[model samples]
Target: MPHSGPSASGDVTGAGKLDRDVLKVAAVVVLGSIMAILDTTVVNVALQELTVRFQTSFATIQWVSTGYMLALAAVIPVTGWASDRFGTKRLYLVALSVFLLGSVLAGLSWNIETLIGFRVLQGLGGGMLMPAGMTLLTRAAGPQRVGQVMALLGVPMLLGPIGGPILGGWLVDTVSWRWIFFINVPIGLVALVATTVFLPQDEPERADRFDFPGMLMLSPGLALLLYGVANVPGAGGVSRPEVWLPAGLGAVLVAGFVLRATRIPNPLIDLGLFRDRTFSVAVLAMAFFSVSFFGVMLLFPSYFLLVRGESALSAGLLMAPQGIGAMLTMPVAGKLADRIGPGRVILPGIVAIAAGLALFAGVGAGTAYWQLLAALFVVGLGVGAAMMPIMVAALRTLRHREVARASTATNIIQQMSGAIGSAVMSIILAGVLAAKFGVPTSQGQLAAGAALADPATHDAAAAAAADSFGTAFTWGLVFMVVSAVPAALLLRKAPLRDELVPDVVDVPVGKTVV
Candidate 1:
């Protein structure tokens, strides 16, 4: 059913009339968005600390991060339904409360297993918060202001990823690793209160039965697939039974979901949305960029600390420049996107990212620190500029009723792609290390350790690791270059203003974009 309002393009009340209310609601929603995004990378800086504190193997400790990602992937498909069944405001508050509770428990965990469980809990809440927040923001702003709202929301979303490691590293060095989780408490509390008080409650529409079967098929399928992919490289490739079983099962289940969705009236994902050429292309571009961007972001901190011998705090500080570069350029990019077209802005941004990654690929063990900073800054600028445009273009043609579903789809794709990207990078890096240095089998382990105990051997191993990282960065550049092609070709060339303002339609159920 459509909403009861003037046509999406009609001026029921001028923009100024509800500007304050929209801004206030946006503030609350952006806060939740930031918290959700921060959790994605917050634990990255603490991985070394967690490994030491738990006295666990590196592979075991990796689950702390991987599990959260899998849980996030599992929960995202349900957001559109959840928001409809329970009102958006109600669901937002609940998600925030659950997130806060999970954070508190995570901080108090007794062991690695407990911490991983709590992280999953946090991811569950976080997965909902992101899509829900975008749903609310897009609805509140209407089609006219989608770009503006997205631009505002993007600040925290971009900042969170860039800032998480920096903040986490600072807390771990100065305070304790627990503080990384604890920091979300105050922010979540403020967002919860503001949401309850400020957010408008739209009347609920009657809906078809919830798609439980689709959920069963899609959720576990993605979770298991991601789990298998994440474990493959670490398990010494796909030849292992452990890798193939889950991956094969996941593939079959996903195929099952596609078959089931076709038979259902209202599938959980509304896969029909992909029928639109622009929407399909936008989603593809978003996913491709996410794979390359996230893959590189996940690699950086480890490279700094493990390869460069930088302390966690220093590494975080070095990473800060990227955020600074992004912050400096985002507003200008957003305005330019509004004036010209997202495609024009985004294409250049993609090229800049490719250039930055190419520069990073040249870094050696003895490279100057300034060169590293310069490369990161360029990448940050590119990401900051490109992201808003991609989002704006994706939602450009969506009707108000489908906006939530569209946003949810975009969020899920990005998350899944990021997870896959991280796993791919991890495998590539690990494989390079193993192939170059030889596997640490029984005899090899003894010899490698003996060599490492001597300064001469340690230096050789360190050089090999550094060289492997440079090679990984080269691969990363290749990924970015390949991703840029589709983005340039598929994105529409129309100006943002023309895209935002749709023709007025007179439909009975509220005026929606036609």
Candidate 2:
């Protein structure tokens, strides 16, 4: 369908109004996203179960999550070009099918090695889905509706984390660990069908040749960097050569990609996207916010299961407040940004999150449930307000043609930041535990958490573990505060009419033109 706006040669010149097609696009994308986002959190709660099932150490088992993330980062950079080459709708269906197959294989895995390999396949599918879907929605909506559309799109991102753990825990406890992966199949199928029926079909655009050199440099660099960071907990600390060597190599590769991209006419991702002031600030803010938010997400389930001796189901239920808070605020935040500007909303949102993290820093083993719930809710509100608005601001500032590159850059940055957050926080938690218990952090955390499950030593281990987690959460607070600086740099411009919907004929706010 053409944009519901004036064409360049047509007589529609005033501000463009939003149409129902934008909402339709948002709904289609959110369904696919729910499958992907839910899978991530479900696995987080299942990490401990995987360790015992596989007879492996925490260090080895963490690879399941790390590998998935690394694969996601590796594949995300090429999505911009791939979407253009294959056509977004065709690529989306293929990606969904790939993910569905990976999920089935994951459920049948005979060993940890097989499981991780299958997850990598899932990641490959997921990497394309997010950016491509975002590009499709942004194009369909135009700049005028980015904020409201982002709110609708943000639903899966917020709700998945909230619901995944609860569902994952129930399945793990009542059924089997395999069910976590198996659950994606039904959801994926539904999304695939809905998309085929509802989505607009576009002809493939003329895309440039693949940037193989750029891909080789960027993908491996990201994978290696995340790999090195993920090893920090297992290797004891950042001072270890195991942590430094791959990280150093990754830095060199990424720098090379940047230099190479500068000279090339069409790179894997357009580094030029960063030249837009709104886009740059939005990316930077999201990077900082992602590190803190994703890091804490990893920390929380373990805290509940290990430090508080809660069941996985209980821990998941406890995590619900955060998502609920986000759900409540996202629509409001989106509308506010459309009127006032993202920075105004984002600044306060960042502060609220920092305050919530501060509350976590002060938590003790015996802290009441209500206190943690309140803080989590505050954190969710901040997250809902900050995250998608920055994305909206960034996309709104770009021409419609640039939305693909913008979405790619956004996905890559968010994934890398999340990978970094999870690894760094894991290292911090492990370090604190190792120091407190006089053992390697990875081994200590696993042993202590496992020990707490036993009735005899539950109380003592809980107290000690809680202190270690509290300290690690303090570091998360620091990251959140640092994120605010970039958020503050964001421009104060409200969303404007974009060039993509030149076909849209301006209409009255409450009036519809068919």
> Can you write out model 1's per-residue Cα lDDT over 40-89, one digit (the tens) per residue?
87777776567567765333455566667766766676655566666777
Tens-digit per-residue lDDT, 236-308, candidate 2:
6689889899989998999999999999987866889888888888888888888888888888877777677
Q: Which pairs in model 2 have colliding backbones?
A: 4-504, 5-503, 5-504, 5-505, 6-502, 6-503, 6-504, 6-505
Q: Model 1 TM-score?
A: 0.83
Each candidate structure's TM-score, on Cα atoms with residue i matched to residue i, is: 0.83, 0.84
- After superposition, the stretches of candidate 2 with alpha carbons farther than 4 Å from their true spots are 1-31, 55-60, 131-155, 190-205, 236-241, 276-278, 395-404, 454-456, 491-514
For model 2 the TM-score comes to 0.84
What lDDT does each candidate get?
0.71, 0.76
